[model samples]
Target: MSARTTPSPARTAAFLTAYDALLARWPVQVEHLTVRTPHGTTRINACGPSDGRPLVLLHGGGATSTMWFANVAAWTAAGHRVLAPDLIGDPGRSVHDGAPLAGVPGLLGWLDAVLDQLGLPRADFCGHSYGGWIALEYALHAPARVGRLALLDPTQCFAGFRPDYLLHALPLFLPRRTAARARAYLDWEAGDGPRPDPGWREVYALGYADFPATRVVTGPRPGLDRLRSLTTPTLALFAEHSRTHHAPRVAEAARRALPEATVAVLPGLSHHHLPMAGAAEINARLTGFLAAPRG
Candidate 1:
């Protein structure tokens, strides 16, 4: 499916300007890379020692690879080589010049190609929101390629979206969607607590209205059997105040389906604030789970 069309030059510049300012806050050296995949040209932001344990990060919808800013510092400090990518067809620099990756296979295919080109045979995987769903599917689809899996408040993995979420987010899909509405919708989701950085928030809203083919390609939810049979050690973390669905309900389903996985909810977190909130705790849980040796 085609997206809203290429963003205007002015709008694109605005996003980059805001994005660059936020990126300057990264604590360590960061390398910007463009890799070829069957799906399109993928933009990746990488840091940490080149020989450290490889860890790939997939950002939630409307959040480009830049979303990892909070966790990348701690993760890299722990000696993880972090690779965060702008999902093809989402906002940021990735270009969807090839045929649309129509189904789940295509989504996994894109990631597969990315790693192949990067010369990584296997690596740990972590994703947030929609990206989490993709990471889960990828781990299940290609278990051997994945060393471990970490999910952050993923949607459509263990439970369907809440009706209220769709109702509030409906304006984002309409042709009439505007930057103001996008900003307001985000404000609604964030409620009283922390939200994105002011500069990055502007960038996200511009991309949300200007970026094309976003929030598309949500394939059917992963099968329960596949989930139950998953052998890859997993971490399923949810937002306590997530508006997407009942957090406890999803956590219960995760326990039932992937009984061996580490599942918990971060207190005071809402859907949008998930990755940015409780950075120290989030970093600890993620680093600890991923760093643990397999039994």
Candidate 2:
């Protein structure tokens, strides 16, 4: 599928600048930690202090730990520990010797090793897009270890695919430079600026450049049965204008799957805006959900 094109030069430039600044003043000090999984010692980026309740932030496909840059400070300020790890095969700092786990089981295994190394008895898990899928899988497989689960506009709930993925994939058949330009254009569209730290663009661009095909594809079409069985309290936050307009259906499916889960569609935000444009709202919702007494 050909990449969808959008017109927004000013917005694109602003996003690029903001991203660049973020790279310069990276708030979180990152360390290269190793998790001894059955596959091998998977390298991951661990951040945040050891005093607060551990909150793991998992980034989406093609994105790194920086994806959660907008939320880390707020979460930390709220007295919750944050750990943002770059998905194994992605562009960020995580090292992948062979092909990392492709589906849900592999993702859970990697996360299990990470938690074991950190000595976290149980922690809250938050995932966006593909990361959300991994988070759901982890909670299902290890319900006892997940204090709370939060998913932000995750894929797989609806059978629709994002246009950006199609665009990124199209470049494979084109020349390297053309593919690079195509990716840059798509990245600009995905990012929302007019905010903080202009250096984020360079970091995102580098990540995209380094790992163009970092997406993890699911094995088969698994129904929502597993998600329904989750005993942990779940919060599924849907962006108002997500590419997949199936929020209502997704929420319904989640409700049917896990009757205890709460669903809310965030207003005045698109899929790309949840982390950037709707940071405050996202943080507030998360804080409230985590603070609520368990069922």
Candidate 3:
């Protein structure tokens, strides 16, 4: 509530500059939009053919819409209109009023308002990490508004978070040593992939230092029966080496629970590398899922 912390102006400026540099690498026609919700405002980046099937992309916590840079081109090439919204209460340009969203209910309300303003009654959803959890919640809360769901290493949706994750993350809280610690954590997640680009890495660290930290309310964990009840076409990907949870267990549970869904544990991948290590493979899988005719 009341923004856990406010980013300093200087740090915000630096973050924005680095964000722009990362965005510049991907050249695509985009329409910037602002949607008004009852509680706050959301910023959305729209791309692809105006008449194509609507596909909403949601980025993970601590990341913004720009996180989809690697996947957008593939989605657009598959003839789907893509909309990436910066989750409010994160480091993005979206702004909220007095308090951050109060868990799932607030999140749904904000999303509904944004969709309404975009003139979309229903759309396919693609989300990564925390955003994936949000998409799963949306599918359950407002089933009719979701055509299908694609979750990329979503956290705390299929399984509980591993306790050791916090222990490994403790170094990130230190002020003076945060950057190095953050980079180490990210590197661990990235596995064998080369380090992230300089500009992107710099912005990530700056955002980590400056962005207002907010509570991650992992609302009620739905039972397997609950997930099984949903009929929406679903695709859930779990990283084989994810530090968030036991990926193999989660993948198995997902497959057993959601009989109609396609679930897989990606080999040699982790949460953060979902957008990098096997980006093209993930994009192809997603595009194929979206393109298939629903039974």
lDDT of 1 by residue, 1-295 (tens): 4332355677577777767777777788999989987777989899999999999999888888887777899999999999998888888888887767876678889899999989999999999999899999999888999999999999999999999999998888888657788899888887676775676677678777666535477778877997887999999999998888999999999999998999998888888768777678889999999889998
Q: Between prediction 2 and prediction 3, which has the larger lDDT?
A: 3
Q: Count the backbone clashes (under 3 Å) in each candidate.
A: 2, 14, 0
Tell me the deviation in Å of residue 228 in model 2.
1.9
Q: Give me the runs in candidate 3 sitting further than 4 Å from their true place.
A: 1-6, 173-177
lDDT score, candidate 3, position 283 = 89
RMSD of 2: 6.9
Task: Give the top-scoring candidate (TM-score).
Answer: 1
**Candidate 2 residues 124-155, lDDT tens each?**
99998778878877887889999999999877
Please list all clashing residue pairs in model 1, or write none if there are none: 3-213, 4-212
Q: How many backbone clashes does candidate 1 have?
A: 2
Against the correct fold, how does model 1 do in TM-score?
0.96
Clashing pairs in 3: none
lDDT of 1: 0.85
